[model samples]
Target chain A: MKSASFHLNLLKDTERLSSSPVRLRVMLPVVALFACIGMGLWWAILFTQLLMVRAEAQDIDEDVKAKSKAHAEAISRQDRVREMRQQLEQLTYYRNGVRAIGKPLAKLAEIMPLKVQLTDLSFAPPPLDPPPKPGQKISPFAPMTNVETQRFVIAGRTTKETPVVALMESLDSAEFERLITREKRVKSFRQDATAEKGGRRLLAFEVEYTMPERRFAK
Target chain B: MDADYTTVARHFQVNAPWKSISGTEVPSAHGQTVVRPRSNGRPPTGKLPPRLTGLHSLAWKLLIDLMVKIQLTRSKTIEIGFGGKGKSASNSKVDMTGVELFSGESRGAPAVRLVHKKDGWHILAAGFVPPPNGDLPQRWEDTPHQPVWELPRNFQSPSAAIAVNSGMSSFSQASAEAILREMSQGLGDSRPKPHTAISPRLSLKPQAKAEEPQKPAPIGRKSTLPPPGTPVSENGRRFSMRPLAEEGFHLAASLPEFQALWLGRLLPEGRRPTAASIQLAESALMASPLLHPAFAETKGNMLAIFVRRDAIYFAGYRKGEPVLWRRCPGVKGYDAMRNAIGKALGVEEELINDVLEDALVDPRPALEPFLHPVLHQLDLARAYLAGKHSMDTGKALLMGLPYGASHWCHMAEESVKMKLVPGHPFDGITLAKGVDASLAHLHLVALGAAIAAAEVET
Candidate 1:
């Protein structure tokens, strides 16, 4: 038989005491207080970080809004620049179409024959294109072709057609190459409205000559 | 007509009948009277007389029930003592201290520390500590005072068991043998001794045997008490019981409700040893001899007489289980015996030990007056065991008395006709270095308290 069979203990469970010096009763509250304080400090740190991050996010949002508006304005200015460039390029084409007519006129005078008394000398431009239709838009600054033909009509009391022909042949020479082309025509010779003092009734003649073409280029 | 007996009356009305023909004579057909037993030794084999059956049983049951109810009512009203409420479950490595308090002397009481290591218990220390100077408070409202004893470093342990000798604590015991004897006074069942010799079976396989011996009755079959661990109240006292190995036998102990709380908290919890178990002094004394070799040699069939300063007690064991525990009424303890020896021989207090141990002097004049009644009671316990359990107690252990053991032994051999063997409480235990073995007798209750409190389950 075990010795417990003879033991008759009178102590109750509640009355038993701890022999150890370290008591949970005294230390429990202190440990719990420290735990609570530590948790509070940790939560405070997290709260501070959250506030700082939120402020940084707000600043970034405002900066993005300002940058977006500036970007839109820059794009509109780029479109306006492209439209002005196209108009300027058309104006440059008009400026390049000017013809040097003074040199050609001076050369025509020099190549005129002495026998041919020139009463009237003028250049008449050739009809180069048909008239525009009703609804078609035309740009005035650009010409259809840089080359042109002009008829040089010569009318005078030339007395005979030979003199006029001689004048035409002289106009076709290399000295008048920039002024006139080889092609020419004689129309009719008729007496002038009044005879010269010598009482000679001269026949009146008309001649036409082709002029060189004028070019417009860069 | 009583309200409490109404149920019993209704029970009898509904039941068919009950009859008792136990040990009655029957007339044979040949004109001769014969006593015949049933073939199966069972009840209700034949018809029985029914005239006074119900009335006889009803009257007896009512009387017993009324007595039990009155006892219970009285116990529940007022309890000023306490019972053991602390559990003794502990690790094998924890050291335990056991002490006996309020041990009749004002100065000090016995104390010891025990530990169970590799094989068995070893004593760390043994001696005495200051007593509780009658500071047993009866209620929680009472003012608390400083503890009388602070265990020395050598005796201090992780846990302590205290055995107190106070009027508030009580111990009692009863067995199935006692019940059997009461049921039939002189009808002794002297059974053959339990089979102790080895069996002669050499077969490799188990074989059925028609010649197997019978075993004793199952435990608690004839118990007259309540279930173990439950309290039983009688004569205005409440008790708690623990069952024994022997069938229908149990050891019961009790303490006042107030006293249990006080004893449990007597040792303040701190650096000093805390009380792990609180028990009565006699209850601890009952287990003092459990570690002795005599118990193991007899296979736990033994008896012991404990002589204390104030009282004498008898403890009986069967198969290491408690079979009997009784305090001798009217007879006093060792102090009374010593006083008687001193007055009879007219010797000084110091020379009293010499007269009893020295065969040169005849101290029968004083010894006979004290020993006759104590041994006569022991003989009665022995006779009761023989009639009921069929085991002969040839020798009984005597302990707790520091002197006059030889005289008590001589008187038993001469007048009582029983052998008395005095035992040392530390006989089967190993003592550590510096532990004094000579003082083993003085720490009987403390040693038993430690042994019982440090119960190692086998």
Candidate 2:
């Protein structure tokens, strides 16, 4: 009798490899071969390009060097121009500063009453603003620095307070007040205590005012 | 081992003179009567009519001629047995009147003995025997030795008969040799294996029954299909997307075939693409690049119709790069068209002959209904291209119609003119060898994709 092995159905549920190992073996070599060829061609083309670039570079060597030198010289010249511009701005700022002070000083003389006697005059710098804290909203209109200010103090004894008041009114004119207040030009103002002077039953007072400091472009 | 069997055959010979029977005699002048059997060999003893003789002769001639013709036409010779060959036991001859048996015995006095029966002839004796000394023979073999049934010495087995019928003389010899060799080999290795039972690895087990069907998943789920313009994995093909040095540009390449398509990012990479991306622009990003060059060649904004067996893919390109891709069902894909063509062409559903042929000749009729949907798709694609890709529609729209569908060029151009500039893509780009008008038009999508892919910054 024949063996029962013939009736057996082996290989059930066994999965066949979808991608053949033989195919992979063949494909890997073929792929590698093609890849090598591709790389060879790529390198060949790259070499050719490099050679061409080198030839072009050699051809334009002097011209490039000359252009580089010219570019460096132009940069230096631009730096000099920028420095001169800064200097010119500073000079303008100084001139403006002197004018600002002179106007106020000249106004003080014009505004003073004939009965008022001047004892002393002085100047003080503008007050510094505190640095901003973290997360604090800074106002755009706020002055960035205390570089723009002209503060002055005037001391004199007047026989009557009317002249002093008149002097204060004269100084409060729109032109002077605008310069001192609108620009945050006048940071502070105060009147010192009165003092008797020269046996005229006179009252002595000291007045302090600030005008905007002069600024120039940095 | 060779096996043998024996079979017996019997032969007999007989003759009878029944044809000499006297017919009815009539009284005539001088009392003379005639017997007609002597004149005619047939029992109906009379002269045959001339017409009958002529007819018989004609029949014989025709038969002879037919036999000759048959002999000439066939490779083998035609033979009609006429009782000249050696006789065998089973061989017998019959005629219209009675049957005749030829004698087989060489020892007996040659005598023809014929038996006459009402229906047929039977062997009466081997020959007429005159008893020796006029004494009746007592023993059965004594009277006249009748031919006894003799066993045949040779009778072929079934295998031998098959071999003989097959005209292979060596088959039986080879089979005998093989059997003997196997026997010798088996005898030489008489030892039995330790494990006569079936091996565990070779044993069979009952297969598991199929499980019940699972519930359907929720809708709006992402499909396994790749996003439009993204490379798809195909059997025997590999597609990989490589980023170009330029931002928002990618090269999708398939190796071994070297089919490449260029992808322009409408949405940035790494983001999950929308359903629209997969449906509208899948072929553009994922399809082969053979479709891209026409717009580049035409150097204008254009809509390209790529006709395939199952679907017509449409893509609009600006400046030689594909902006959108859309797939419209081909006539072959429709059940109605498929059934109609199947019946008309007498072909299966898989056969796309009629659909392709009709589209080639005059597609306007069959494709008329579907063109609206295609037009809608094109409108959507064009809208997307214009709205998203910033492609200008004002430039002349060049239509890349298939080579076979050139008849529809004017109609397509006119239909598309309402929405786009319809021109030929071949007007501008210089075609390399093999990218002719026909191929460029037919596979506009693939070519466009390829051209776009090559543009990658690599």
Instruction: State the TM-score for model 1.
Output: 0.56
lDDT of 1 at A61: 95
Provide the interface RMSD of candidate 2 in angstroms, 1 decimal place.
Answer: 29.2
Assess each model's interface with DockQ, reporting 2 decimals per model: 0.17, 0.00
**Local accuracy of candidate 2 as per-residue lDDT tens digits, A102-191:** 565677677779978888777665567678888987644335452666666667777667877677667777757634533223223233
Prediction 2 TM-score vs. true: 0.25
Candidate 1 interface RMSD to the true structure: 9.6
Q: Give the per-residue lDDT of model 1 (tens digit) for B229-334.
A: 3333333233445554434344556655545656666676554577767777777888788888888888878888888887888877876767677677678888
| Best-matching candidate per lDDT | 1
Candidate 1: share of reference interface contacts reproduced: 0.47
